[model samples]
Target: AMFESNMLETKQREIVINDIDPDALEKLILYAYEGRLEIHQDNVTNVLRAAHLFNISEIVDSCCKYIEKQ
Candidate 1:
């Protein structure tokens, strides 16, 4: 919706995501294309939060499993 809107038609064509960790965002983007990502002690929490916010169930489930094992 965001991309289909006038936001993309503008000259800037930039979508700003606020209040998300840069590293978590990068991991989510990679996971979208690769179908996999690393969930570690350092990033699991942030990644899980980001995944939940984006409604990415796969990542959220994986993060939950990783957390449970810790």
Candidate 2:
């Protein structure tokens, strides 16, 4: 595995932020950073999409559990 010093790498972390609005993306980043999230019911789908995209497995599962419990 060769990680060059300067070249851009496609093997970087899989975070698909392009599908989200900028403000919501910022919020998601903050949640991942701080472990505290303030999400609305309307935005659950967006959050689930982000969690799935970023390979945050636990978050995706938790969202599923929460939805099932609702």
Candidate 3:
């Protein structure tokens, strides 16, 4: 979800990207802006990969914890 300016909305909107699955790109922005997400059995790997690519420390730690649960 990018926070860039959009003429469609009065203010910036949380745009859901279609080309990229939410799992692959959601956590970086979500964790960066909102600081949380339910990373569980289903989408943990995708989130982890996104976090690693984006170099978000909090997200990386969260992903590690999810992995350890298995």
Q: Each prediction's TM-score against the native?
A: 0.85, 0.60, 0.60
Model 2: CA > 4 A from native: 1-16
* lDDT (Cα, tens digit) per residue for candidate 1, span 1-70: 5556676545465668887898999999999989779779999999999999999999999999999999
Clashes of each: 0, 0, 0
Worst 10 residues of 1 by lDDT: 6-15
Q: Across residues 7-60, which tens digit of lDDT does each residue of candidate 3 receive? A: 544363563444445665865666667766768888888877777766767777
Cα lDDT tens digits, model 2, 4-67, are 5543454676534467666556657877899866566666667777777767776677667767
lDDT (0 to 1) per candidate: 0.89, 0.67, 0.69
lDDT of 1 at 39: 78
Enumerate residue pairs that collide in model 3. Answer: none
Query: How many pairs in model 1 have backbone atoms within 3 A of each other, for residues 3 or more apart or on separate chains, i.e. clashes?
Result: 0
Most accurate candidate by TM-score: 1
By lDDT, the best candidate is 1
lDDT for 26 in candidate 2 is: 62
Model 3 misplacement above 4 A? 1-21
Task: Find the number of clashing residue pairs for candidate 2.
Answer: 0
Better of 1 and 3 by TM-score: 1
